[model samples]
Target chain A: MPQGQPEVVPDDGLTTRQRRNRPLLAVHTGSMKGKSTAAFGMALRAWNQGWSIGVFQFVKSAKWRVGEEAAFRALGESGAGGPVEWHKMGEGWSWSRKRGTEEDHAANAREGWAEIARRLAAERHDFYVLDEFTYPLHWGWLDVSEVVRTLRERPGRQHVVITGRYAPEELLDAADLVAELTKVKHPMDAGQKGQRGIEW
Target chain B: MPQGQPEVVPDDGLTTRQRRNRPLLAVHTGSMKGKSTAAFGMALRAWNQGWSIGVFQFVKSAKWRVGEEAAFRALGESGAGGPVEWHKMGEGWSWSRKRGTEEDHAANAREGWAEIARRLAAERHDFYVLDEFTYPLHWGWLDVSEVVRTLRERPGRQHVVITGRYAPEELLDAADLVAELTKVKHPMDAGQKGQRGIEW
Candidate 1:
């Protein structure tokens, strides 16, 4: 509610209310933490609005089982808000429990992107979270220009958020909102390691 | 789960496992969004870990209930995870639905701080989110030194996170992890007004 006022108002012809309702292509990209966490937070808000949610994790291991996945799974099943579907395109596509080669990982990442592209075309979900998605683009596994083009031309009123570090300039240019998390200080700097509840 | 490795490891006598389990005092601040959102996301992790969670909002209006409140309340009641308690020390302490004078707001903020301090002393919650607490310290409504000292001396392995803009120097100095979210760009920058679900 304390969200700041717009510093610049564009002359886009649309009324304020109409402009405000437009779907956002948000990017959470930076070297620090909370990129995916913030995206998940936004998904929580979208869910509260009764928007169907889809989350695709690109980097984290499926065996790790992050907290957002479990809580969202429960929230979706609770029948109190919107439906949630979580997909783990984990490191090497860990769902198969097989370690893959470099080419195999690249192929899997491309397959994951293709699935997301199909979903966007079909307008299957109101809100989609491509959690840690930038890695594939950064690693040159996914074509950045093509990804940007698909997102820019996404059909219907679906909101999509992409998160991870080193987001390609093309993707950032296409995104309507981008939040960069910078690390001022980290416990790791003081020899403290990540804890169970705090980090994951 | 994709959290990066520590660039530097200290010889602090504590084993890696012991250091990894240390409690964190995290601060999320700067002139951007996702401060409170990221904090709530971390709370989601804490909940999944079955930690008792307490959220005290120092700035957001209680009347304009944020989506996190509803979702967390649901999670707390569902008996599937941790217990959660949410307190809104809204603008003018709006729980009373009275627009208070400047002095009244200051007193209410002080009262809120005292409550948190007491809870810290009692080890009331395993995870604590002091949402938007820096404004009071920045506005001189609360003592920064005392607040920092209390958090530094909090009992047990409680993890505390404070979120807002312009965090006080002493608090930042004492914090274990500090994340400054820089707004690369926002829909607001393009004149889009805040909407119901996405903004709140």
Candidate 2:
């Protein structure tokens, strides 16, 4: 009332401070050997704890691949409280020789990552996982420092898990815990073909 | 007279020869910074050369944010020609607040990655970018050595790109090109908020 524009009254009555209670958990794996399975189990456990969760696939192009989407569907169908929203990379893979232009690819990647960041901010998930995030960093499609900064800046007590082969030392330093996977043998080495359900 | 189980027929009409094409140009950006954007641009450039491309987001959980998915979609729509398929991580981020009987997270991660590997094997792409592949290695979800061997053993002249923050030095040594995105300045420091379609 004193000023030309009435001072905007802070809606303290309507505003309820959101309690940041979740922990940021980074799960960095060495290889793809058993990552999917392990990730799934951990997600289920968290879901059982009544934690709202968000799932994301960092670098995947195929619609039919039964990795992230399948797991969510199965869990939701198996009585998980809510369905896990799935997001897939539209560009199947960026290594095609027929690509049109660099700007096009950069724009695409930027859009894809922007979408992911938006969801992370909007949703009130207790846990957020950045899957195969290393690819973007490795390919130079995403800025690693920016990503790390985003992770560090994400508000709330949300636990973030990053799965991939190599986690930057900086990320590891920032992480509360770090685990490494080493492979001694695999069926492929014995000339056996990958099996569905078991392998896939 | 035919021998038991049909005499092993050695193909005389067809000559078994390998094509000596340029080795698949694979780039891995371990440091974060702008690696994702760089990878996307590089991939798009490679695509313009009329080479079939495959992009794999090794970690499936990190891309859940809306910003991340939108980036990929934009890329696909930007006349890159052909669809960019994304393999999503259905399970939310993997973290064990409480331990259980089974190795759930590991199992889920493995399944998703196996699916990706299967697709890579079946599809014929000129370039394959494995995004955020390092998490699997750090988490003990996948086999590092085995993955390296498989990548080395892949057929065709397909180029591979692996991006992550902490790529093993061994991988860097083996790679044809290795880049690290170092962090210098970030918007977070300036108090600039993450804008939609800008920072994902």
Candidate 3:
């Protein structure tokens, strides 16, 4: 795409603006990092446009203080852009010092997906980020077919972006935009561990 | 990487914390829309860490009110995180209602690179984003070897990220992390034009 111009224009009957303004179902997936980071970046753009934003973290614990979460929460309260709501499934529950059983985590993930489904049905948010959501679908904790169907039929101008590794093929087929963040190189390859602010 | 852990730990004669805290040179390239957006997301994390940020937009016009720029400017002013300074070369100059010759734009890019070099020498910023910088190297407007050398030898712990398509081989070779944002699918394929708040 040259300066955001499409390479091949389809013979759609819609006007340029109409087609351009359509809501997007974007998926950021790959083994490399930056999947959720890129999704949060899009959320920033949506918030800048005064679009209500909702973030659901599936893998991270609610106690985990991600820098993006803090920044966005401050931005939401500042009344400069749009409102933001952050929720965590705490399935992986890192740093919480308490681990749930696999079955318990599966149940928790299902509950989280149910909440997202309800919100989608109600058209609650202009932008929805299912952060690390692919885990549930990949692990068969959530039904891939039902998730795809619901997202495909989601109403209003809601833009939903899902980020995680191993995104289901069904979800990718339903998405309008899919970004695969491939790693050519990483400092981790040089024996570096994750650091605060940079990695979190 | 499982929970930010390196797949293999090397015996590099450094402690975990020292190895983890090293600054990074990241390059976001490939034909996709979210390169700059993802880089901005990293900037948010850096800001939350109280790191001074400097963004140099090599392609966008100076007058264009990019949503990220506005949100970041507000964040900088609010004193909620670190300070942010944004600069534009106005090379593309879209929406500026004025067209500069190719040579003029090339000169402006060189000037912008010079400014970044000066800042790096002075350690003026903790984080630096060279937005759409690959265009200059790809078009032969700037010396790729020199840019790579300058970045590689830059003093202090300042982290640098360059974003754009067609990143030069030398730059990728020098970078510690290179994320290729491959476009799996796009709405533009359906003849969608770029829309405000999303594209800009």
Model 2 alpha-carbon drift over 4 Å, by segment: A1-22, A63-68, A77-79, A90-106, B1-200
Q: Candidate 3: RMSD over Cα atoms?
A: 4.2
What's each prediction's clash count? 0, 147, 0
For B1-200, candidate 3 gives per-residue lDDT tens digits of 22567878888788887787788999999888788889988888898988899988887565443778877887787788899888777743332333455448877787788878888999999999999999999999999999899999999799999999999899999999999888888777766777665666
Alpha-carbon deviation at A34 in model 1, angstroms: 1.1
Indicate the residue-level lDDT of B154 in model 2: 67
* Best by the lDDT measure: 1
**Residue-wise C-alpha lDDT for candidate 3, range A33-114, written one tens digit per residue:** 8888888877777888888999888874554437788889878987889999887776433323344554477877887888
lDDT of 2 by residue, B73-143 (tens): 43344443334444434333223223233346566556656655665577566666566666666676788
Candidate 1 achieves a global lDDT of 0.84
Worst 10 residues of 3 chain A by lDDT: A91-100
DockQ of 3: 0.55
TM-score of chain B of each: 0.91, 0.68, 0.89
Q: Estimate, for each residue in A87-109, the C-alpha lDDT of model 1 and write its tens digit.
A: 77655543444545444667778
Q: Per-residue lDDT for B173 in model 3?
A: 92
**Reproduced native contacts, each prediction:** 0.71, 0.00, 0.69
